[model samples]
Target: MLKGLGESLQVTLRKLRGLPVVDREALEEVLKELERALLSADVKVELVQQMLENVRQRAFKEDIPPGVSRRDYVIKIIYDELTNLLGRRYHPLTLVKRQLTKIMLVGIQGSGKTTTLAKLARYYQKRGYKVAAIAGDTFRPGAYDQLRQLLEPIGVEVYGDPNEKKSTKVVKKGLKYFEKKKIDLLLIDTAGRHKEEKGLLKEMQQIAKIAQPDEIILVIDGTIGQQAYAQADAFNRTTPVGSIIVTKLDGSSKGGGAVSAVAATGAKIRFYGDGETIEDLEEFDPVRFVANLLGLGDLQGILQRIAEATSTEQQEELMEAFKRGRITLQHFKMQLESVAEAGTLRRILSKLPGVGKGGPFSGLPVDEMDDESVKVFLAILRAMTREELENPKIIKGTRIHRIARGSGTHPDLVRALLKQFNQTQAMLKRMRKMRKQRGVPGMGGIPGMQGPPF
Candidate 1:
């Protein structure tokens, strides 16, 4: 999603950094490049012009603080401007504990509304909330079946009447059904309708009146680009849309357009669907999103995930070892296991500074390894002796063969695992040395390395 835009912006930034001196002319050139990139990504013309103007004004007017390079200042200005374009802050879906929060989902047809409902259900369920979903979309064929198939596997109960044609009645009955269940969150999946469908809109209004939902979310399809504005505008006018969810962003090159267009309408984008699975939806964070676009990496998100995957004592111990510039196979194994829950290997690597495109690990094959491959690597490690685990240099040809046999893998896999381990160790050692030279302990003092606010 918006990968091309990100790459273009990265190239422009690289060019700006390579210049001997960044004058007003160079700044203008960068802005032009940025404007072109945003336009190509289907961002609204007005929004792109506004963002470029802001960048230009700030780049020309702001004084270069002492010790801060002019290139860095320009980069900061661009980042700020882009973040503003995408809504300046994160808008989380605030849920009250022990409260039955009724969330009504509305969107156009084929916008991935049903799938997003399942994802939302999984998200709340993982947070220890008693969540259930109501499939009020009786217009679409198999709407009930689809919702049931997606939600039931994740332990979220779904209520719907396939033969019931009245969406309002279905919602009313579903609400009544859950009233006695003590459900913490009830997600109502309303039928998708066009803006001009007066009959459908009236039905939606009646359903809303009956449900009295705490939040009415408008789900937008990212592939529609700027055309999403019409749907968002129409829905907001029909009933006050509390928030928005943009779906199918994973492969949509026009995702930028969808996001920017919706933001322009003043409705907060609460979440976005980045993949096909139930766990693919993520809360939209403006700062982190802009950082990834500018190739700065999501350091805050990564650190927070790491903290969540490890205990405080484990964190302190790891920090101590990192400070000492020593990372044994044991530590590596722990990190791999912990990061498995964090996200995919590519996602984790992309969040690391100097590990993304044109970064230190850009050419590394570790990003190509999936979860199963990682598990196999872990198994190979488990087959090794304590001595070999501690000192990988002792693993010879026969030792590698024996471990591979024990782990049900080939010797080449064992060698590949060792190579990856060595590469990771080397990268960590280099980072530690760089931090030491800067008089920082571990990675704490590094820019963008701070943990997220829990």
Candidate 2:
């Protein structure tokens, strides 16, 4: 969601890819560009310098592996360094199954802490957890109402008392209420407290003591840039923040600053809010995030999103078919349905290698296809016989006409689907060969059947 920084990085990588040779001089030029980009994005100067130093050492010293281009190797080093700058690995919320997991959210005022709490609650609720939110923001007017309005619609129960000015008392009562209900996750939204507000900070400590939260999350505003470090440090000093959530990243130009600063604090970033919607929160993954930023795409992230959009049974069936490399037309149709349900074709394509912004295939008209086209493709597949669907090679010109008639679509559309299916099969064959060469087990193919056809 750090659009500015992502675009800047992508442009720098694109220039590097065009270089005749990835020598020390080229590497130095690229690192200079990166330094400017990072500083302009408000990233901490020290972190940026450290990351560039690491990248420079590896880019010039590392031996290029067989079957890899020097340009690609340099790009890989940048990706690795940037990922490490964010966080080396993903840190998931420590929630015990079938037990109450109390998460206390603390941040400064206007940091979108209340909204983030709702997003977190919805995130857990979707995973089958019995989630309840406690609005302990006694200092903010209508904070309880705001949380209730955002949470109740999502079926997450909200526990708050506007009359109770004592935040600790509210948390204590909310904890008791959820304990009696045996809720799986209890999210406590504390009042925003600045470092200067010792009274508010002390109140946060009191609430933490009373709630005894399993995890204390500091929600920081992405617009704050490098100042996020001070905010997080102040909160950590008060209640010992275990995790961080950066909000409003979608609109913040300084998102890089906030994210990198939080990483500098040694606090794990558990989640990030990219949009205003409740479903916009996503678990932060360093590798995937950097991959997307570098225009390499995040196939794993796209697959995870697709899995979440589909049912458990559907996911299992898809995974089994993929493992066997036996993805049929029926399976392909199901995948398209899942992709449509998950997001638009443009969004899905943005996560595919060489297809996202600044990638080689970025100019493709993925945005032109809409729900109607997806439904028409599914209809054409439904019109096909079981044998033809299972063995697409059996579908000849005659079968294409018949299927088009049965599906009430143009024969050209049917032929287009077949062409797309053939392309997908070819891509899968190439992926299988690559996996074999790399000694990787399993199909190692794209989770979806095919890339979006322009």
Candidate 3:
């Protein structure tokens, strides 16, 4: 994750978080912080100034939505602006049926092109694409061996010529070799070259002519600070780059140098390699990226994750409980555990409409149930019998004592948990009535419990 920029944005958001009306002066203060954050992230000064001016103009021109507060609206504006700043969206690589797509990887020296090639290979390979890789980086000593080691174990066909010095000739031979097979995607990894390295740059250009790739992917090294922009520009100038991949982003918090780089290359960033592992590559989705960057926890992403991770039968059971307007100790525990499962509870709550600071559930005691406390509550839940869990009314006096003993906790602790559950149930009933007043649809499922730790 882009931690540095994320923290800066979050700090800016927090400054306006509870403010019902964000006046001109307050917004200016926040914008200054935002400008600093983006600039620090290696975003170009011109882009940063333009974004701030746009944000300022929009704040004055735009009206807050009917339900959303001014603060939330401002946050939305920032999110939209950030999304716009980051290429808007990545160009999704869609493999055509019964068609062989060729992709050429080119980048400056030590930009992690070879590893990215393997990651892309695995990414396509897992999706049932007949993927193959070509070791066109003949200048590198262990380029062929490295490509082979990465792809061979994964059952991806890797072609290379150790004897060949010319990258263009190697790529030509590789294309001829893979043409006989039913390969879907042929990835050609060209040797690393600098903007100053005319010979290597020429070799890359020559290879592009020889291979006539469907897409020329320019890989930018994320850790190179602001030099990423120059790197992308040089390659694109020599041979037009179709799409870009940013590598070595893991633990990178200082800046997103790719911002200026994308502007220079005029290419949509397709993928980002976040870690050393092949599985760490992800689509550079601006929406989710900005949403997560500001710690808003990507609401749609949360919904998608819940759909993927939870079963329909389980959802139905939870939905039934919500419909009855009575959740058992089990349902309560599920709500608590679900928050623990999805990152920090604060983030999940931030996405909810009027919940955390200036919302309806502002003082809902979220601090009481942290991760450790959730674990204890879950343990207490586990100690209860099926009937007691389903109908917590039975767990009084001796039953509470028994549960406490069984769960290795004090009897008062069990009582405290029971009391909190009662309080939460009452609050949820009030919320349901409010939802009805607001004409919101019946909310259910494990995802319905996607906010505020306990």
Q: How close is candidate 1 to the true structure, as a TM-score?
A: 0.65
Tens digits of per-residue lDDT for model 2, 140-255:
89999999999989888999999999988888888777778988888899887554546646666787889888888878889889988876666656555467899988988899
Q: After superposition, how far is residue 25 of candidate 1 from its true place, in Å?
A: 1.7
Each model's total of backbone clashes: 0, 0, 1
Better of 1 and 3 by TM-score: 1
**Model 2's TM-score against the true structure:** 0.65
Q: Tens digits of per-residue lDDT for model 1 on 1-454?
A: 4658888888998898788888988888888899899998899999999999888888779655444566766776787688789876567887877889999888768888888999999998999899999999988899999999999887789999998998888998999888899899999997776545465466567888999998888788899899988766666666664688999888888899988888887778899998899999988877667777777542344333333434233444555665566767776565555444334323424443322122122233444556677678878988988898888899988999999999999999999899888887777666667767888665554223243201
User: Candidate 3 residues 1-454, lDDT tens each?
Assistant: 7658888788778777756678898899889999888888888787788889888989878744344455666676787688777765436778875689999988776888899999999999888889999999988799999999999999988889999888888888899999979888999998875545465566667888899999988887787756777656665666654677887777665437565456545667788888998898987766556776777543344333332233233444556776777778887665555544332323334343322122122255432566667767877888999999888888888998899999998888899888887897788788877777788766532244446312
Question: Model 2: residues >4 Å from true position, as ranges?
Answer: 195-200, 236-241, 298-454
Scored by lDDT, model 1 comes in at 0.76
Which runs of model 1 end up more than 4 angstroms from their true locations?
Answer: 195-201, 297-454
Ten-residue region with minimum lDDT total, candidate 3: 353-362
TM-score of each: 0.65, 0.65, 0.64
lDDT for 262 (candidate 1): 84
